[model samples]
Each structure stands twice: as C-alpha cells, then as structure tokens.
Target chain A: MSDTFNFFEYYTHISQEDILLSYKGPLTDVLLSEFSRDIRAKLQEDRRTGKKVFAIFMEMAQNVLYYSKEINHFGNNDKVGTLVILNTETHYKIVTGNLVFKSSIPLLIEKCEIVNSLDRDALREYKRKLRSAPSEHESKGAGIGLVQAALTSDNPLEVKIKELQGDYAFFVLGVSVEK
Target chain B: MENLEIQGESGVYFIPTVKLRADTGVCEISGESYLEDTSEFYNAITNWLEQYIREIKKPLTFNFRLTYFNTSSSRSILDVLRVLKKFQEQGGKLTVNWYYPEDDESIAEEAEDYMKDTGLAINMFSFEPEE
Candidate 1:
C-alpha cells in the first residue's frame, strides 16, 4: 500500500469543520506561540473562553511536543506532531496527534480514563496531589499539563489510539472548550 | 552581585521582564515568558535568587505580573517558587505577589495552583488592562 496521506481529503474534512487552523509537523515553542497569538486574535470577543481555549491548547500542544516518536532534526530539535483548532457555533475544539512508543499507550489510556471519570472538584484534588508529590528528577512532568487541559476543556477527554508499524502507535487527543 | 535587568521582548516566543535588585531585595518577573530555551533563560534568575538569599541576607519580595507563560516555562516558575518557599521555611523573609488582569481568571487559577503546591501565600493583585 502507498504510504501517502491524502492532503486533499484531510483539508476537505477540516474545511467542513470550520477549523480556524490546522498544522502538521514539528511543534516548537515558537510555533506554539504563533498558534496562541492566532487563537487570541480570532477569539478576541470572549476573553474567558479565549483564555480557556488557549490554556487547553498549550497543555495539549506540549504533550505532542514531548511525547511524539518522530523527531524533527531541523531548527529547534524536537518531535513533530499534528495540531488543529476548530471554532463551531457553540464550542471550540482543540485536537493534537503524535506518534508514541507502544509501551506508553497503556499509561496514556489509563490517565485519560481517570481524567474522564472525575468531576471538577476531584480533578482539582488530583491536580493538587500530583503537584504536591515529590517528582522524580528526570520526570518529563507530573502530567499536570494533562490535568490542566482536562480542567480547561468543556467536555471529558476524547482520545483515540491507533497501532502503527513496529513499536509505535499514533495517539490523538481531542478537547473541547465551550463558549 | 549587581542588579539584573532584562527588557522583555515579544515575538514567536516571549521573554519576560526580569529585574533582580540585591540592594532592596526586590525581584520582578513580569510580562510574558515562552522562551526558546526555558531552562537556560530561567537558570540565571534562579541562580541569582539562590546567591542573594545566601549572601545578601535581606527580606526579599517577588512581584510577578506575567500576562502569559507556556507550560514549560511554568516548570521554571515552579522551580523559582520552590526556592522561595524553601527560603521562607528557613526563616528568610519572603513575600510573593502575582498580578493579573481582573478579566482573566486563567492566570488567577494558575497562581492559586502554584500557591497550593508550595504551601506559600501568594498575594493576588488585579489591575485593568490597557486599551
């Protein structure tokens, strides 16, 4: 089978969703800032929703930045991931996808389940516990970013994991922020 | 050590304004911080705080008025806060205040979360945004 992804098909779907922006490739601090500023510019009317959308965007964006299996060997060496933001009549959707090692999938799924299961107060408590706990010296994060993303999102975590060739899998997370 | 002052810059990535004054023991990190290198930029600030606390031996006040910061930068912020909290536990006079626009509760929630983590009182200040 051809390994080509159909850009036309993907963009057609994007256009239908009224996506404000969609990007595929490496996610750097610079690119993240650009997306952030764009979100602010587009959603200037609602400061609260803008902030929440931005917050959720940042957290989810970082997950792609840190966890993606495919590395960007170019400017600002880092992993590459796909990121998309949609503006609908009632809500904003921020979606990010990246390749991850197969070994990490179970943990990611478990974390998502827990976040999806909790209420706002329990989520806050979970965040507190994670934040206060002593961290391993080399731990990427306490996964507080995910917690913050879930809290900022309008709905529970929406995740899809697909197995890729070898020891890698594609992970996509979609978060919604209602206006 | 002499005071450290860095003019904040905004672009694809923002560097927050950093001013550390040893004489009056006042340090302020304001504006936005989403850096090309989070650790390299923040280590200088944390190192200065460490030195000042050890040698200067004066009351320190930190005023943070950051409008935006990315999650990676937030880690460095927590590192700085942890240093301050440690100093406070060791009988160092320390005061931390975080300022945000009254309209944005996102920053406020983040500040409160920082306080919750460090077990330190972070005074909140609200201000009007310029048109």
Candidate 2:
C-alpha cells in the first residue's frame, strides 16, 4: 500500500459521497410522504450505528422542510430547499442549505451560536423557558430545534453563509454524528 | 361541539387530530404535529379545554400518541399540558398518557421534560411498531 493518494481520483470519489435530495412541487399532502420515504432510508443506515445519528438526521430534515425559501416548479407559496447527507469514514455528516431572506440571517446565526454554546442542561432549561413564553412570530426560531440538534450531535454545529443576490442569502448548516 | 380534525403536512405544518368529549371527559390528540402556524392551529384546542374545565367541570383524561413533532409544535404541546396542569391544580381530576416509539429516546426525554415542567403525573408508554 502506498501513502500517497491521487488528488483528482480522491476528489471524484469524495464528490460521489454527496447525496442530494431536493423538492420543488405543489404543496400537497404527498410531499410529506415523499420526504419521509427518503429520510427513512437515510435514518435506517444511521440506526445501524446508534440512536444519536437518527435524532440528528430528523432535526436537520425537519429544518429543511420547514424553512427552505427557494421555490421550484411550484408557485411561490410552496416550501423548497436542498438536503444532503454525506457519509465519511468515521462519521455521518448532514448538510442542509436553503435560501432565506437576508434579514433573517442575523437572527438565525445568533440562535445557532447561542445554542452551540450551551450545555445539555442549559439547553433543556432554555427549551422549558421558551415553551412557557408566548408565541410571537409563527415559524421563526424559538431556539428549540437547533438546540435539540446540537444536543444530539457529538460536536458543535458548523454554519456558513453566502450572499445570494439582493435580499436573499444561502444558509448552510453542517452537523456530524459519530458512526 | 364538533370535533376538530386537521390534515397533517410535511413542509408547512403538522396538523394534530383532536377529539374532545364533553360528556365522558376524554380528550385525545394523536398523530404528528409540525404546523406552519403553531399558535393558530392549537389555540382552538386550548380554548376548548378551557371551556371544558370551566363549564363541564368533569374529570379529564389526555392521551397523546404523537409519532413526530417539530420544535414549534412542541411548544404548543407544552401549552396544552399547562392547561391540563392548571385544571389539575384547581381540584379537577386529570391524567395524561404519552405514548412514544420504543427506539426514540428523545421522545421519552421530552415526555419527562413535560412532566417536570408541569409537576403532573404522566404515564409514559413505550410502543413497538407493528410489522
């Protein structure tokens, strides 16, 4: 066995690891079923390793379904986004990136940072306090889902943002669970 | 009063099916809940429970068999549990049973969190999926 690896060949192989799943159609009831089917397959593979991976997968998938803003095929009313699950040698990484309004990025990043800093006990307490509070906005972060995802994953969440034209930005979150 | 039934969706919101009985005092909220408008969808259920606690003034049993719910829905669920807790505190009979999947530890922990938050006795049931 040689220690040196071919860069181009390795890059091609690594790119194949990227699993892309996108939805852009009518906002009908079947959309849930379709998304569930794809997620279930990924989850089954995660289940073979442990429960934590499955939990992380569920949280990320739900976020994409709930928050993605780029509409395709369907009218503007439909929810849209891209979700990718990649498998490395030692960990399963979930990368979910979606189009969100530029104004929402700051708040979203703030919440992610807050959740990433908290320990499990503090996160649980935070969830309790938010639950007790009154609802303000409909789907904006109440700091529950991201917190749950952080608690479930072994490492802190990795987030990146890119400017995508006027009044819109691409938000990407990468979470990994040990296999 | 008529029963409340809303369809569940994946993208927008999860609609939880609600069945409330004034006569027997049995209330059941089952199915998944990940809704677009969490408060708007659950406000009716909370209002109905309030009316039941005030007018009917009978013993109540709440059964929750939700398979999956997002974070927003979970907050609304806490609201529902709080209403039940309030009724129990006021000398009203109450019981809550939360059924969860056997493989899902998060759900069990969530039920425990609710129990701690409300200071109410809740029966936790572990269920195995049917083959």
TM-score per candidate: 0.86, 0.76
lDDT by residue (tens digit), candidate 2, B21-107: 877888888777766567888898899989888888789999888867767778888889999999999999998999887866677
Q: Output the worst ten-in-a-row residue range by lDDT, candidate 1 chain A.
A: A133-142
Which regions in candidate 1 have their CA more than 4 angstroms from the true location? A1-12, A71-78, A132-139
Worst lDDT 10-window in candidate 2 chain B:
B3-12
Model 2 misplaced stretches (Cα beyond 4 Å)? A1-33, A45-74, A77-80, A99-106, A136-139, A163-169, B1-17
**Most accurate candidate by DockQ:** 1
Weakest 10 consecutive residues of candidate 2 chain A by summed lDDT: A20-29
Model 1 sits at an interface RMSD, in angstroms, of 2.5
Please write out the lDDT profile of model 1 over residues A42-119, one tens digit for every residue.
888988788788878877887787778889888667889999898889898999999988998898899889988999
Q: After TM-score superposition, what is the CA distance of residue A118 in candidate 2 from its true location, in Å? A: 1.6
Model 2, position A134: C-alpha lDDT score: 66
TM-score of chain A of 1: 0.89
